[model samples]
Target: MAKTVLITGTSSGIGLAAAVGAARAGWHAVATMRDTGRADALLEAAREAGVADRVQVKRLDVTDAASVATCVSEVVAEHGHLDAIVNNAGAGFVGTIEQHGMEQVRSVMEVNFFGVVELTRVALPHLRASGGRVITVTSIGGVVGQPFNESYCAAKFAVEGFMESLAPVAASTGVQVAVVEPGAVTSEFVNNVRLDVPAMLAQAGPYAPALRGYVDHALKSFGSDNAQTSEQAAAPVVDALTADRMPFRIQTSDWARDFVAVKLTDLDGSAVQTEMTGWLG
Candidate 1:
């Protein structure tokens, strides 16, 4: 019997690659996106990889509780059971802390942190039934700090902490939890970030140079073709699902491995919180 793996954010990038990769690897790949109609590229990729028949596209907005519940239930109803889940549906928010109001921070966290948590909460019973794997597609920023991405980094950091806390609980039930930390992968995530440039920020102040430099570097690095492709990042994520052995933390690129190693190798919650004080700014 073929295993079934459901993944989110399959409109494009690593999520789409992972969807097709799972199908090619002989799993029933349930590729989900915020809007099913936006999955043309995912469909094409699956077709080109000769995995279209094994792949299904569904609509899911992970932040919406009703949508999350209905989607997971529907997948289980259609497939009989869900063997694995990849929480890859997330976006970026780039702005200074002062520029981002509580609403902006909450908006980012709703999608990046709470969205994954709630969806997994609803899907846990199905996954637990099969001793399935749960993969959270995080970024290097999840482990380390970057200047201009306070909101995005905070959300990822929250995800890391949540997954860490949930891992032991899931282990008791035979469900394995792992995180994929990709570094600067070439994706639309950079261009699509919600940048809330406050009125004060538009006038240029003392912190303007630092903020501009951080944003410029992030945009240039993340948007460049020279960066690792989303397909490359999906390799380790797929490994996290199918491999006989899994690590709690799987870094995708060399930069990610280095960054996560330095940031997360020794620090626990207290240490991380202390270190991240200056970063949340």
Candidate 2:
């Protein structure tokens, strides 16, 4: 009678680690990704952790409503109940407002914001039935916007607001909600962005200098020793899934906690602006 938890984007990074972590904690982890072809690493990790039997791989593309519905339905039908869901599927975008097309901006929103809403919408009834919880892996950028990441930050901002607003309402129905914010983690998330520096720099009209500076700063930060490991970041997520009292907001590491605190305490917004300005060199 182990509880079930469905997690999206488990091909690598935090989602991969969270899936294995949940299985280790005795929850049946439904590890899902947009493409099952990329599941070898997750499967290997599960086997190494001795939790392979508890981790099930499934296909779930958050951007597709049908896929979301089918995945949730299958999990509930097979497990008889779904005790929790981890919305960890997301994409990274880098560029200023005018440099990118509207389609690009919309695409970012569709995956990062709307996708979470769609999956959560379809899973709420079952979550209520099982008194389940919702755990979303957002970024520190969601709280404090960064330069050259206007679109990505906007999408994450939207998610933070949506979840913050839905938390109280969900609690009334015996379902808990929480958002896990990770500053920077060593993972494939950055690689997945697929940035072509030379081409991008050549095309940068007025924003090239800023983009260059931001890219340099970002590369250093991601490669720095301060960045958390995927397992370290996913630890808080599993805690949220199983803790006795889950908070509405959870930071995966001390660095993330400190970074987010700037926004929470900023009264005039000058503090966050001042900090981000440095990223542009």
Candidate 3:
């Protein structure tokens, strides 16, 4: 019997790649997204990899409480147990503090922070029963806040804190916890980002020049030759799932590892502020 892993946000990008990758790696992947209607690409990729029979596409809207509970229940019911779960369903928001209304912040939090908590909470029982693993897809921003990515980064940071805190307690039950943080990956995530550079610049007021400079630098870095592809980003998630022993934090690349290490090793923390803020005009 193959191990079963349920992953969220598989409509495309890393989620899609992880599903197919896990299937090829010999896990029965329950690839899920808010809309299973968009599963064509994932299914096709699974077919191409000759793992179609091992992959099952399901609908799982992480933000919906009932939906999260139901999806976890269904996976357990179908497989009699779940071996792992990858929390990849998330959205991004780009704006400064003044530009983001409270509602906007809450909306991003609902999906990124609260959604991870919801699914992980519901799946913990089954995971404990099976001594399963939990892998969350976070971002480098989660380690360090960015200029205009206040909301998205906040959400990631909150979830990172939650996971780190839960890891100890979860270990007592024989459940492993890990978070895979990736830097800029070539994915539809960029296309879906709620970015409004002009609008933000207009409202940037005294912060305009600094905001614009940071945005420009960030965008340039994202398009550089160093950006990881979705497949590359998914590699560490597969590692966490299949490795004999998993680490608490796994960065997808050296860039991500170094980027996050600064935060972890920054004692006073003011050094990081000075460095990252220096990117602004």
**Prediction 1 global C-alpha lDDT:** 0.84
Best by TM-score: 2
Candidate 1: misplaced stretches above 4 Å? 187-189, 194-204, 223-226, 265-281
Model 3, position 156: C-alpha lDDT score: 96
lDDT of 2 by residue, 1-281 (tens): 99999999999999999999999999999999999999999999999999999999999999999999999999988999999999999999887777687999999999999999999999999999999999998899899999988899999999999999999999999999999999888745459688888888898988888888888888888888768889999999998988998999999888889999999999999999999888888
Clash tally for model 3: 0
- Clash-forming residue pairs, model 2: none
Candidate 2 lDDT at 32 equals 95
Q: If ranked by TM-score, best first, what sequence of candidates would result? A: 2, 3, 1
Each prediction's TM-score versus the true structure:
0.90, 0.98, 0.96
lDDT of 3 by residue, 117-179 (tens): 999999999999999999999999889888778899999999999999999999999999999
**How does residue 165 of candidate 3 score in lDDT?**
99
TM-score of 2: 0.98
Per residue, candidate 1 scores C-alpha lDDT tens digits across 102-186 of 9989999999999999988988999999999889998888888777678988999999999999999999999999999888877
Q: 16 in model 1: Cα distance from truth in Å? A: 0.4
Of candidates 2 and 1, the better by TM-score: 2
Residue 145's lDDT within candidate 3 is 85
Model 2 misplaced regions, further than 4 Å:
187-189
